[model samples]
Target: MLAPGIRVVRGPNWIWQNQDDGEGHVGTLCEIGRSGSTHSPEKTVVVNWDSGHRTNYRVGYQKQYDLIVVDNAQIGVKHPNIICDGCSKPGIAGIRFHCADCSNYDLCATCYGNDIHDLEHSFVRYQTANSVGVRVPPRQGALKIQLKGIFVGARVVRGPDWEWNNQDGGPNKTGRVMEIRGWDNESCR
Candidate 1:
């Protein structure tokens, strides 16, 4: 699936021709339609154009693509020095989850999502490939808190707290958390 923040341009399959189409324009992907959603039965790639126009283009409708990827570096952070300990993939793509408790231990996004690391240890998330990592203080005691819930680089949804009108790509949509602020013990933003 094409991720948000990816740069894209009009593809050759874009059949629509308009003077306001802004040819040679580049846009950032903002949202993608869920495959099974009622609102968007077809795969839709929403883009925010640099020309101040926001619109969604078709991906697989009629087996054609209206947009093509120009750059995907924003989707995954590249780490030249890090190799995933779980999968042994070099230059871990996407978010790099480094074990705070283990020395020189790192896991790629896939391994981390699959729960490949020791759950007892907390991890620091690197959102960008070239991001400088910082150490997270070890949790008190040996409570063994499972690595779950909201965290930086975590995919999130509005859930039951949703009250606005499709603010986050509508129902069943998910977005990545770039940062957290003023977090409390209750985990309420």
Candidate 2:
């Protein structure tokens, strides 16, 4: 589900029947209407457009989406002078992970989730953009093991353990691992 302060644009399925004037406009999600509520039975999102226009749009009403998420970052939280070391993004969004062992080293949620930094070192997870951060130590008794065969850019296919529906084309579909997250022993990607 989308949260407030996320940047969005008009979806591919946008139509003139939409409640607001969001055509060719970029906006930030201001509020989300509760599903099955008295006011809004269908899922809806209120947007504050960059052009100073504010309006509500349908999310999944009638199986059609009106808004597309451009950037999932929460812009309400500001962290001055902090830049992501992995992607070099000027402002880290969502949960900011700071390496406890490295000085002035930080990673955004995407980078942290993709294991961009040294996994041997511990990290402090910042719940918000400007939070003091909560220390997240490495798992106990877990040995540091290298990925035997899989590496970034390596093409991989769905294995037998795949449980989800065929969302990536089909069973024979292949995709590359953009980044590897967590320890190899932890069974995370």
Candidate 3:
């Protein structure tokens, strides 16, 4: 019974197929969240992915995903300390890609380039500072998409209803957008 908030790596034999539902298969480290029983106490787990998407699955399928603790959990929060295996840099910031199959080999943005890593290899990219969950491999275009309008790390004026941590700068406050999931459909209106 993997509890919520615990990160897990997908197993080799793991199978995920949801292309028809628009949320394609997920093959990255994901946090176990949102669980409950429906009919006969059959539990389910909602996987919170780094790509700003959530997927649900039966609870007993924990064996399909192996849970592992990260060594540089503070990399993104305190400081970008994870040395880039590709470049040997001291501080690798922004989105980082880690290969779970390759002993968690990590590559910084500069080294990653246009997802030049082994195409046959599977990777998971995540933000160092926040528990933004895990994302699939070959995230080259993700950089372009992120660089679009209102990318993460951009400053914004907090509205009166801003919720998370009101102590920073409450109503009419200003703060940096920690992460960007997707476009706001109503931002134009």
Candidate 4:
């Protein structure tokens, strides 16, 4: 019942007789990874019953990614975080509560506690503002940075793993299009 591309381990070859209930020719087989990115991977094959032989199979190569999300301190969950949280820096690990509602920058602890941002830690902004193709809310998540705009088929960039480095965290950002609701304030739709 295996597919053409999938390879199984070739089992022992035994003579077929009306005596054995486990009828039909079978070879225990295991699959293997493919080769080049554009080429198919290699695999091992088991010869049919009554024969002891080895064969080769291949699986196509594919790209993979390791993605992870860092959590914020105060919120204790995954949210958009700024570099410094104003300036004082956050938690020792440098990972803390990040405002999900963000525009282009983040407010460090100093800025948040101070009257600089008007006591508001996070805020959102529209992509281009004026009338365009899509109808999105003027305000978005303050810490969130959406690229292509919100739609079924929008452009986006892909990245791998979570960069917890406050210094390098900025590079973790990707051009992703997200559907969000603004009336709820920090709520991500």
TM-score leader: 1
Q: TM-score-based ranking, best first?
A: 1, 2, 3, 4
Model 3 Cα RMSD, 1 decimal: 10.9
The models' CA-based lDDT, in order, is 0.66, 0.66, 0.46, 0.29
lDDT of 4 by residue, 4-103 (tens): 2211221233222322123332232323334442322433222221123333332221222111111112122212333444564432221222344454
Q: Worst lDDT window (10 residues) for model 2?
A: 180-189
Candidate 1 has its poorest 10 consecutive residues by lDDT at 180-189
Off by over 4 Å in 4: 1-75, 78-81, 88-103, 108-110, 118-189
lDDT of 2: 0.66
- Give candidate 4's TM-score: 0.16
For model 3, residues 68-177, the per-residue Cα lDDT tens digits are: 22222211222256777887776565556777668847776556654556655667766554445475755534533212222357566644335677776666666787
Please list the Cα RMSD from the true structure of every candidate, rounded to 1 decimal place. Answer: 16.3, 16.1, 10.9, 24.0
lDDT of 1: 0.66
Q: Flag the better candidate by TM-score, 2 or 3.
A: 2
Clashing residue pairs in candidate 1 are 76-94, 77-129, 78-129
Local lDDT at 76 for model 3: 27
What would the per-residue lDDT of candidate 1 be over residues 152-177, giving only the tens digit for each residue? 78786675436888988888798998
